[model samples]
Target: MMKYSTSPTPSTSSYPRSTSPLPAPANYQPTTASAAVKRYKYLRRLFKFNQMDFEFAAWQMVYLFVAPQKVFRNFNYRKHTKSQFARDDPAFLVLLSVWLFLSSMFFALCIGLSSGQIALFVLFVVFVDFIGAGILVSTIFWYVSNKYLSVDGAGGDVEWGYAFDVHINAFFPPLSLLHCFQILLFHNLLSHSGFLACFVSNTFWLASIVYYLYITFLGYSNLPMIKNARAFLLPLPALFVLYVGTLLANWNLSHMLMDFYHYRVL
Candidate 1:
């Protein structure tokens, strides 16, 4: 009896309501539960690389090599050349090598004059090879994906960003794979403390072989036209042999330089 009737418990229709239709969802809104899972599955399948590591390598290379248009053109060159290591930006590579070498020397001199200095130099070299090589590999991927690998046989005409989509996709695997090899090389190199580390630095040699194989496989796999595994491997073996010759040449040059310095000091 003491309780009020609460104004007839407020009829369901008593609440204020808008007469206009509800707003549509924004375009950038996240997918719902089922759709989100589906989207993730597709993304995972597409990338086929370690997500976080690949992303880091991609970002590093992106910052290091950010030419908008020419980056993709290089891929076109690679497609025609068939596994040839075409030089896109020689000046950039030379400048980076010089900068890294000089910077390492400067740091080595500043820090100490012992095996420790050499160790630091080696670390710097590894960094340059990993990050610098990362940029190169990313650029290559961008080109091939844009030029050769296509769902429909019709990619695009040679425009400014003919390979923009391919470039975006290329940023990940090559860098990820390269970084993985770099780690392996660093581990092997650091484990020893001599100038002529065992077998003339086969760490990078083997790593490069692995990297080349992966790139060839990736390119062939993505493209419907060039699916012949045998055809792909033919060019790769020759490239690998050439790379070995280059490695030996580089080693001999470094050895001679060191010997000259030692003689001059004596």
Candidate 2:
């Protein structure tokens, strides 16, 4: 009547003026609720030995040293399928914890630590070096990467758990190199004051640091939303300079580390 045309009325279903928001997909949910659920589930299974997938964690450990980039590829797949980058299974953490314990024991023995000293040594390594430092580092990287390195309008956020995982991954090769392999050769080579000892020990330290940086780069670069992950490797040149400095100064890193640990425990 009032010059109405053939335009049809907008469907309420498609163009609602007011309605509840859509439900999240199965893999995606509100953050607080999802985090609470995940935490509860992860902790509940922590002591439940049978429920943890140790095999997968072992596989990750092997790949971490030999083919580290391949290890991160699985993280990408997990992000797609689980809608999160962090691991749900506690197996890797469990394996890492066990490794830290065993390696620390061997380290204490190699350093001629007494029973009480060994206890203190293991406690320092497991608690301060691994857990406390891990949390601090994880928080720092999580904040920095999300704040500065995340791509603009990338949408997804970096989880603290994922950051911790990266730390543990980077920590592994160094632990084995320093605690296990270095211990094997400590008395023979690394503890000596010879040039060959300086070169070899410093080289091992250099390699350990490089592994940490490279693994960290792989972890962050694997993320679809992260940019400039090459920033992780930026320290390599400085580390090399420091390595050469240590060699020239005849600073046996492993010997110094042994002395430091023994001093701490004493």
Candidate 3:
């Protein structure tokens, strides 16, 4: 019987054990889990209405319209006190969602859409147009700012949630313009197909886009650790050129949008 002694494994066991932990992957990040936790907490707070600061949110909305730059002061304060650039409260998001729902519903009704169609339109606009598109845009800007616009030794980075907040803040004016104001003016003024209608509608769009860009600039510029925030405003001239091009081409963007919505839901 050839006895292979299990204890005779000195060759295998004699190697020195490395006390240093194995290196993590080059791209492995713990911040991903922290971000996920923050996102989860934000979503969880959505259902807890009693815990939301709606009145402050309403004030913030008003400031977003009248004095958007002032809104960032609160974010700055939040950074100082809470040590984060993003809002923990979901009141703003909830209020914006409610406003979006109401505005889209009324706009659909004004366009003579059927009840069922109106519901679908609302869903498409709120979910697809607002939330979905907002997330995409936020992610793009977040990545751009973090990857490209970051300073070398700033010791801080842009927060994805903060980027999202910036997007929604910028999105508010456009939403009001296109969904609420344009609908109000549609039958009376914008329904006509002419240069005058084009000018009015196009100007609304231009102003709304300008508002979006300006607010976006303010949001990024307000971040203490961010640099070259003026890059956000670079698109304005291009937007102006496009606005002119659309006008010269006699494109009734509002009409085109209405048709698109009709095609989608009707």
Candidate 4:
């Protein structure tokens, strides 16, 4: 037998040692500022405003009013998918808010509101009445759907985000029409028209509002989770009450502002 060397021979490895640096930690936490910047970028992307998007959104707004079922059927809830609804687009909402603000400002000017009153009107009517109310109503619907009814066969809950999309799309047409009527009236466009024209315009506005409510009813009725008529009807009363209450609150706020302005002037 060959005598084995007592000393170990130098090892000859064919593989080179890994010179590559180890990968950074997979769960590395971003700095707070970096995270904030990421969110800002995300929001910018989500709310991107372009002329084509605006035109499409305007068309969808009309389509939503004319053929809501088709619109709802086509609505994409996934953030990754592109959406036509203004509610789904931040830029659209921003545009809408700006339009509302300008409209309210014009109304205030037409009414001869003081600067303070105009400010209040912009704050309350544009911001609170429209945007805030949309959010609040959507939340209410979302809560009612989740709390009282099983939305899907799999017990999937109604998401507030989707509720908001539905609510805003269904709600905005009538609301915008109402604003348009106000604008026309304030600008004396209706004054030049005969009584019949005025009557027709007012009637149209009222019909549009009724249609808005009807569309809302149809919206909830179409949900897969709403199994029976009773389930469908349950949410209606609350929604109607909320709708009426919003109108009353807006009226009251306007009157109160006018009264306060007069008092101050006196």
> Highest TM-score among the candidates is held by which one?
2
Q: How would you encode candidate 1's per-residue C-alpha lDDT over 135-206 as one tens digit per residue?
A: 565556445544554345543222222222232233333333333433344335523545445334443444
Candidate 3: residue pairs that collide:
none
lDDT rank order: 3, 2, 4, 1
Residue lDDT tens for model 3, 1-266: 64332111112122232212234445544343476788898899999987777777777787778778767766765565455779889998999999999999899999999999998998899889998999999999999999988888977789999999999999998999999988889998899989999999999999999999999999988876678989999999999999999999989899988899999996
Cα lDDT, all candidates: 0.39, 0.81, 0.83, 0.53
Off by over 4 Å in 1: 1-136, 151-200, 219-235, 243-266
lDDT of 3 at 70: 66
Please identify which of the two predictions, 1 or 3, would achieve the higher lDDT against the true structure.
3
Candidate 3 Cα misplacement greater than 4 A, ranges: 1-33
> 2 or 4: which has the higher TM-score?
2
Order the candidates by TM-score, highest first.
2, 3, 4, 1
For each candidate in turn, give its C-alpha RMSD to the true structure in angstroms.
19.5, 13.8, 17.4, 19.3
Model 1 worst lDDT window (10 residues): 5-14
lDDT, candidate 4, 204-259, per-residue tens: 45555666666665565545554442453455566556555645443322233345
The TM-score measured for candidate 2 stands at: 0.87
Task: In angstroms, give how far residue 208 of model 4 lies from its true place.
Answer: 4.8
